[model samples]
Target chain A: MSSEISSRGPADHDVRDQIVIAATEHFSLYGYSKTTVSDLAKAIGFSKAYIYKFFESKQAIGEMICANCLQDIETEIRTAVNEVDGPSEKLRRLFKASVTASLRLFSDDRKLYEIAASAATEQWQAARDYEVRIKALLQDILLEGRQSGDFERKTPIDETATAIYLVLRPYLNPLLLQHNFDHADEAPTHLSSLVLRSLSP
Target chain B: MSSEISSRGPADHDVRDQIVIAATEHFSLYGYSKTTVSDLAKAIGFSKAYIYKFFESKQAIGEMICANCLQDIETEIRTAVNEVDGPSEKLRRLFKASVTASLRLFSDDRKLYEIAASAATEQWQAARDYEVRIKALLQDILLEGRQSGDFERKTPIDETATAIYLVLRPYLNPLLLQHNFDHADEAPTHLSSLVLRSLSP
Candidate 1:
């Protein structure tokens, strides 16, 4: 997140960012079940009370770390949106970027994502929240396509966008992503083409 | 399995079928880990030795029951294919049948589906096998569409169909199916329309 400083504006944003990084490292190196908030604070040269001042509980800190990882994908989507010339290209890039970025979280820290994928647990709420945000981002891209005439206007844009998100669920889902990663690692590319062709005017 | 009688030639089919039905009932009601082959044998008024003659282990019986359920779905797809007129209609019916049937597994027997979704376990192989058959069924639909000129012939039908399966993973996968089932309960309709629209010539 040191590279993401330009996206921040809060006075204490740096401190929170540092804490997030420290917590992520602690959770990764030692298991999340084994790491406590006090360990996070002690490793970051702060008191446990100070960590609590920012995050309500250990789960909250875990949520923040998950949220931060999600934001990294969001940033990647934003970059894709900005760099493209048309909505089709932007949508393609966004889909590809999101899949690649999300899969990176699993490959980078397998244990952390294993915790995140435990749908029966409380932390799954954070993962579901992240999914909603991703769907919203997809809707935004579809709306842009409708305005630019790259996509047809026959159906409601929201429905079409939501459908696209649903169709891409297998690629975006961490649990399903591993299966696609093996088949020449080309599901995102194939899916982006299928989606683009589906929307063409 | 009456229609599938040709798929087997053994005279002991009746006994095997009864044992399978008993085991499925036990697993569905009491959970897989708690259900044993001995209990299944007793429930069906069969000796443990006779039950062992059919299935080497309790898990083997469980796998057969799962395989039987999956075959029921395969029969559903076959009926849809034979009853439908066009490839587009066949694809639509196939998609809807798969989504609804997969979701039915979760809703109809949450305990059984829950065990199936635990992909880390050994029984996940059966689930994986079921997925491969579903994908093959999807490809068959796409192939018909391509041949009938209902869908474009530019892309490889296999890749395109695989992409569709990937996109609909949320609805088709037991783990993700439960989440979508609680939301609007109409994702199958929406997903079918989206996939069919994408395949149009």
Candidate 2:
């Protein structure tokens, strides 16, 4: 059978997705150490043994849930940046997309984010890798702005990008988890304005 | 006997200090949920019931730990601001002190900070009070800068102060606990520079 036909015909993918979703909710609710694989299995109406067929371990399932959420955010950011007209517009769109994505994912699964944050010690490598990916994307935008002569050239693009990341870091996770998006709105505007002005000739 | 003499001697003072120090370490290592009155007492070589003499509960001890840390930080920021002559200098010093204080306290007792953050959920009113105290201090600095004509009126002083808080927030307790402070040297310097410039006429 063709690869598409074989993969699409099996209910394995659907079950796996359901398992991941349930795991994300449980992990977000109770945190990592507090969440048990058995609880997840039951939540998704699967036996403990059945869960093993889809995931190698609870950590592996947790990783998948986080990866899925991050990948969604990355896609939204990439799309926002590409569709925008100029560096300033791109930056604004990207910031808005990030805020929206964070709120959506975090609000949907606040417990998972809390658990992931709490288990940072165990997931440091994964967290670092995710950050590096975000930094790289921001760097690309800064470089594009530089090439277009729309942004100033005093600071290294990478450093500037990291600065943007630092400014946005606190708000991204909290905007979604809390209902205080209004309280957080000014930071991004101020941060974007500051970054843009610093890059201005 | 004099009131001071009845209150405590040098030996009792030493014991109280030791208990607080021990409690800090235990909270930092084990976090609030895992930490117990018995554990704290054992750590400090006191009876479990005796801990109540100094603190009403583990929750009280956690609050004391946070309050003590924030008080030290508040004093440091005030002193640094007073010694500096201008907004630019004062801003940099303030940022440096904030970052250093965060790294020092969290790096020294990661578990304690983690416990303290978790305790915020358990005691929401206390956490909100702590947040208000810090925000008010920041607001005072911004207002002072405005009055001295060191900062411009691009934004309301209170809003600017809130923006600064959001920018510097990730360096505060919970975020500090989540990330390694080993890269303190590499965080964006332009962040402070940009904020100061934004506030300047």
Candidate 3:
């Protein structure tokens, strides 16, 4: 990875991706407070000054990582919804995708989730922006389901989407980062059942 | 509070209670790593020797505080269940009381919840003990409702109770401490509807 980065031009997009990958590992291991730019630079074989050239600060790097993870999750959810046939199947796939994405993101580096949660409280603007984007994505799926006559939801789609996110948050949130991932399987199962039951005709 | 302590005999129980209260505030403020026996001693206006006389270490003091908080919550829940008239009402009151107690305990001290969540990971024994006690309490309530025909649950009461707790946990867990308590009012409204809808014959 270091050799690839050295071979690339300074302005190459791959360099940015490499930095994010390294930062993700560092942040996961040391958490936000302990993960310095110097450590990230060292991990990726880049100078601290070069790291700052691409990302303004450690917080900026963290924000990018968060956005990247959430964006990937959103894409997966959209693809899953598009591929599945029925309302029940759609809901199952949607939640399964969410759980899988969330678990995968947090599985290797649990501290990233903790940092995200802390960022939500400490950095209101970024956190709220991320939340709005997520809520909109959820709303779109629900609206799509309703339009297809597969889901008969009486509650406002947006409100119901927000509620579902809030209700499933404990399982999704970073605070559960320390819990054994193997044991966390029950959450997605129960949550999918509850949401499907609520939305069932 | 100090006067009340002074009035009690200088027995080990009184000393232990005083230390626990002080420890709660200390743990609530700086969390476990930062909270020290000296800080707790200072908070209680006691010497380090006196502190050690009642508690073995800072970790033990933390354990005691958690034990007391859990006991208080369990007692409140049991009392609420007994005082309420019917299953629906009992369930509602139980939810209300649990939320209220959680809010009261951590309302002014958000770090307490953080400490608890962190402690759950750092101290596995305490976490398992706490989980078992809570499960038993919820199981008892579910059994009572089933015996009275107030709940039409086909699943084993223990499993059903665990499911209900998991569903309610996002709202109640300390990690989501930043949540608006006003939203809690809406939670039970939604939860009761879900419960009634699921369990109604």
Number of clashing pairs per prediction, in order = 1, 7, 0
Number of the predicted model whose TM-score against the real structure is largest = 1
- Model 3, A45-126: lDDT tens digits are 8999998888888888888887776677667767876797766677677667766777776665568776666665465355
lDDT of 3 at B105: 62
Enumerate the chain B TM-scores of all models.
0.78, 0.72, 0.73
* Stretch of 10 with least lDDT, candidate 1 chain A: A114-123
Q: What is the lDDT ranking, best to worst?
A: 1, 2, 3
Reproduced native contacts, each prediction: 0.52, 0.29, 0.12
Interface RMSD in angstroms for candidate 2: 4.0
Error of 1 at B179 (Å): 4.3
- Highest lDDT scorer: 1
Q: On residues B125-178, what C-alpha lDDT tens digit does candidate 3 reach at each position?
A: 555576677667666766777888877666566556766777666445554443
DockQ-based class of model 3: incorrect
iRMSD for each candidate structure, in the order shown:
2.3, 4.0, 3.2
- lDDT by residue for model 2 (B45-124), tens: 89987888777887777776776776776677678767877666777776777667667666676676665566444544
B90-142, model 1: which lDDT tens digit per residue? 87787677776776677778767755565423535677798888788788778
lDDT of 2 at A100: 72
Candidate 2 displacement at residue B122 in angstroms: 4.6
lDDT of 1 at B28: 82
